[model samples]
Target chain A: MNDKVRNSLFYVGGTAVGFVSGFFGGGGGMLCVPLLQFGGLDAKRAHASALLVILPICIISAAIYIKNGYFDVTAVLCACIGVVLGGIVGATALDKLNGTAVSIIFALLMIAIGIKSVIA
Target chain B: MTPQHVIIIVSALGGVIGGMGMGGGTLLIPLLTLAAGLEQHLAQAINLIAFVPMSVVALVIHKNNGYVSIAKSAPIVGCAAIGAVCGSFLARYAGGYELRASFGAFLIALGLIQMYKAISAVVKKKKASKNKSAQIKVG
Candidate 1:
């Protein structure tokens, strides 16, 4: 497709992905990575680029949540500390874990939790 | 451990998964709801806030390595902002039970898709190795 048409289509795709991220309060970056790849980025680049796109979406959603009185100072503070610390470890360890096994485990975990969420 | 410790430990677990480039926040929400005794909205809010700083550090590293391409994403980002506003409103109005149920559905969908992708990748790898061995034998 031509650049104009392709760009327009990606623009629409971005909105859809962004909406999902916002609606879920997260997970938009996972969707965005593939979209960016389709938009011509390599895998590593797509992953990095996805963070850029997701950061803003996250901020906006958080703002809305905070505005609507959903804010929790202690919970958020604690969670952020945990997330950052764990993020460092995870990133460093990413090179060591076999990709296929980790992904499979992750997918299964998601499915299990999802089932529980639906039932309970 | 206290509930606060549970919260920190669980959040760290999710963060580790997320830092590995998987969607940790997805897992974090459910962990918070199930294990941490957080309400759905509050859990979601915490996840959203937590993502900002984590992503910032990751972004800087990725950018330094020349992995980011923010130059061409302006239009996409603009449209995404509009979509985010609409989505945030939708989530705000949706009750906790409804949001929880729908998030469950979304997780199921994503999980299945990832499973398929992971399985296919493994299969492809096996096939590639098989071909390589056959070639070696022939040689």
Candidate 2:
């Protein structure tokens, strides 16, 4: 696709992704990765770019949540600490690994989580 | 486990998933709601807040590994930020039940798509290998 068309699509798709991420409090990456890949990025770049795309959206949504008194400082702090550590490990692993297996496992997990969320 | 322990463990798991390019919020919100006994909205909130830092960490690492494309991602970031603000307000207005149901549905749909993509990729790889072997035999 032409650069103009691709840029427009990304902007539009990004809006949708942001909306979903904000509305649901998460899951933007699921959409963002595929959208980026569709726009011509490789899987690894798509994933990484998805993370960058999500950062701003998360901040915006979290701000809204905080304004509504939904903030949990303690939980957020603890989670941040753990996530930082895990992020290091996972990202490091991503460099050396073939993502196909991991992608499959992740997809299956998402399916299970989706079912459980709806039913339970 | 203690509440503190649970928090740490869940966050770590979320970080790992996020680092892998799957949004951790999907896993984190459910875990907090069902396992930690947090109110649904509150759990979601926590997930969003935690995601900020986690994503930053993951992004940095990905960048270091030469996986990020700034020119490609900038426009999406701008638009997504606007959408996120709107979505957050919408979630607040929609109430918990509606929000949860929508999230559930979204997850199910995405999960199915991912599965199809993975399967197709596997099949394609197998066929390509088979073709290569056949060509070698003919030669």
Q: Number of the top candidate by DockQ?
A: 1
User: Which consecutive 10 residues in model 1 chain B have the weakest lDDT in total?
Assistant: B70-79
Candidate 1 chain A has its poorest 10 consecutive residues by lDDT at A21-30
**Cα displacement (Å) at residue A39, model 1:** 0.5
Clashes of each: 0, 0
Worst 10 residues of 2 chain B by lDDT: B31-40
- Which residue runs of candidate 1 sit more than 4 Å off their true CA positions? A1-5
Q: Could you give candidate 1's per-residue lDDT for residues A1-120 as a string of tens digits?
A: 898898888998999878987777877777788889889899889988888898998999999989988888888888988998898899899999999999999999999999998898
What is the C-alpha lDDT profile of model 2 across B74-136, one tens digit per residue?
867888888988988888777676676678788788878888998999999999999999999
Regions of candidate 2 where Cα sits further than 4 Å from its true position: A1-8, A92-98, B64-66
Which pairs in model 2 have colliding backbones? Answer: none
- For each candidate, what is chain B's TM-score? 0.93, 0.84
